[model samples]
Target: MPSPTKETRTLSPLATLPATMQLHPPPSSGTHRTLRRLQSAHSLGAKAAAQPSLISQQRFQAQNQQQRQQFQRLQPIQQKPPSPARRHVSTARSPQRGRANSDAAPVPTTTQLAAMAMTATRRSALSKRSLAADSMSLERLLRDGPPNDDVEGALESARLKILDQGIRSDSDGMSSLRIYVWLILLNAPVLETDTYLSLIHRGPSPAYSKIRNDTFRTLTTDPLFRRRVSEASLIRLLNAVAWTLHDTREDRTREPSIASIASSSRQSLDQLSSRPGTGHSGYGSGQSHPSSPAAKNRARALTLTTEGSETSMAAESGTYVQGMNVLAAPFLYAARSEAEAFIAFHQLLTKELPGYIRGAMDGVHKGLALVDKVLAIVDPRLSLYLLSKNLTAEIYAFPSVLTLCACTPPLPEVLRLWDFLFAYGPHLNILCIVAQLVMIRTKIMDSPSPNKLLRSFPALQADQIKRTTLAIIKMIPDDVYAEIVVHAR
Candidate 1:
């Protein structure tokens, strides 16, 4: 009920702490400095609290004045109109030295405007070219129909069409034309379904397990390949080819050949003539039978050598290899039917690229050496750089050679390249392998670690490769190209 005392009213919040709190000694210099700042802040806060409206208005006016200054600086300066020549000269003089002022409006120079126009025009031209290219239809190539006698011209025309305009990809519903063009290029005649079915009916091949192992994994990452071609279908086709190869080998082995017999007899005679006391010894000497271990060992060795030659012949004829699935995948993907795929694949293996799937894979090795030789000829600097680092083509290009460059990603691009190779000659694949190195020569040379770069080559840009491959054919000497022919054989 009574009025408050003056002493009580003057007591501050800090004053309410117990005297025990102040019993500590005066704070250290750092603590004392912090205390002074706190005291100053407290006094300023109290003063601001006394006239909050005035403080807010002052802040608002300060913000407006700053904004007005910014706005004034942002306004563009107008100058007397100058002659066109002076305008361009003035723009050309401005080199854009450094970071622009934050307050000033950006003023593009006449040179910048010209550059922008040029870039826009370039973009428009590129777009038009692309549109023109897309406008070419598969029907156009087919409408001309295939030539009967002039095979080279027909092939040349088809290749030109493919280069100018990509094939109708499987994504498009018009792959029938693509298949037809491929058939023509491959020189693969359309096979009857009955023949293919009969091959399949021969049952699973000795290579069936190998085919199944590879079939599912073929282009597993390729959506187009996976979406269109089923693994089961691929397995069936490979198995049928295996049976055909097996049957053919069996037929050849069962049939007697005079050449084989004569060569074998000549080899035995040569062996007998080579050994001491061994010339027609059965006529007078005691040894007619292979009774001694030494004689028995010699006889066994001859048998093995004969068997080895026969095995090698059969393998070179048609036995499947590890990478054959990848080699055949592009064909199967492009071909509409299993029979077409089988015939194309068979032709590719037996005729086009026989050495690739052979027991020794001699073609792959030769191709690797050819890659080195071709690269040395085309891009001598990059080739030497790689060789200096011991990064031979055998280390990096084995897959490329074996698969005929189909192992590269973006299956669509690979297919386009094949159209070119098949139309001309699958032999051109060696040139293509060289083309990839040419495209990325700069990157490889610049990198400190060339092995890392060579470990995985860049993705295929088929158009670029097709052009480069063509260019390489001209760049390389005829002798080198001849070597390319002999390398794969």
Candidate 2:
């Protein structure tokens, strides 16, 4: 009932609890003590949380002070500024941030390095072989010895020699034995001067007008071809070929039919029977029934027609095609005389490449397709890239296929490429074309418009092309290569 003192008033009601109650507190008092403990813990946690930031600030200040002290110690030492050029060089050598790895060139893998090494070794070996081959002259091989009894064996030996050791020619692509070697490879027989001259005298052939149209443009840009072979000689040679083809066609058409021959034979039999037979019964008598001379002539003509019809039809159809002039240009430039050129050219069209010169030129189309296929097999990435640009071999390889790559420039290199072609197989020219594409693949892939770069191919590099061609050969499948072999047949 007494009034409360200031001290009691200041104390909390819970603090005024009896001593026994304090020792054994009620549930609510326990809750209050727990809340106090929690508050104490929360305060401590807050202080701990703030302590790290304070510690970090102190550490930062310490670091700043140390750096200042170091700067003060080095303040008296002066360094010269780099020159602009030196600074530029240093900056260039240094890898920039975020692009340090990007600027560094990736190291080649083991397989790639091995491939490069093998290529170098192969190139060195080829160089050595070429040197050795150059030492053995094909001319000396012929001049030093009498003609071999076995002509075919001798030709095979010469071809092998050419394959192993390319023909040696002057910078102009002239060699004493080049024409002879070509003749041998082409299997052209010895043609007489009179034979060639007689064809020339036959006057303008059915194809003379066409020949004139093409002759002026043949090798027009090639100074070497122009320097050696005149348009007149090319005209004569082609005209002579045309005449030979025309006569051959005439002979084929003039052959007697089987029915006519049979009728003539029957008439001859009737005449013999009616004229003067010892007996009425022709066969019963001692006389025998022999074949008439007319029948024999007819039979021989029939055999001739049958045997030569396929080749005659094929050759006659292509008496002269547009590209024939370009085809003959190389022969004229190589041959010592027009007659030789005519003979070799005729042989080539009639035998080695009849399908090529044919009106349809099916062989050339086949060759272009094969070029695409072989490229796909050998270098698929490049093949796909070209395909992505809608660049097929047909667009760029027509001239190459039709002319056996004579369409490319540098007459000397064409001559060199031809040597290999004649020695091995002209069909290999498809691979040569693909080889050219492979050589310029980098430029083509980097180009925005690859077609422009392909419109006019780079100048011919005979050695590089030959090497690349040889390398590509191993990568081609046998079936694909077989098609390549006969695509230009």
Q: Go through the candidates in order and give each one's C-alpha lDDT.
A: 0.55, 0.57
Worst 10 residues of 2 by lDDT: 274-283
Top candidate when judged by TM-score against the true structure: 2
Q: Give the runs in model 2 whose Cα sits over 4 Å from its true position.
A: 1-136, 144-156, 253-316
Let me know the TM-score candidate 1 reaches against the reference structure: 0.58
Index of the highest-lDDT prediction: 2
lDDT of 2 by residue, 244-293 (tens): 66656566533232223334434311221110000110011111111446
Q: After aligning candidate 2 to the native by TM-score, how far in Å is the CA of 376 from where it should be?
A: 0.5
Candidate 1 clashing pairs, residues 3+ apart or interchain = none
Which lDDT tens digits does candidate 1 get at residues 192-249?
Answer: 6676776677676777766765676787767777888898888888787676565555
lDDT of 1: 0.55
Question: How well does each candidate superpose onto the true structure, as a TM-score?
Answer: 0.58, 0.58
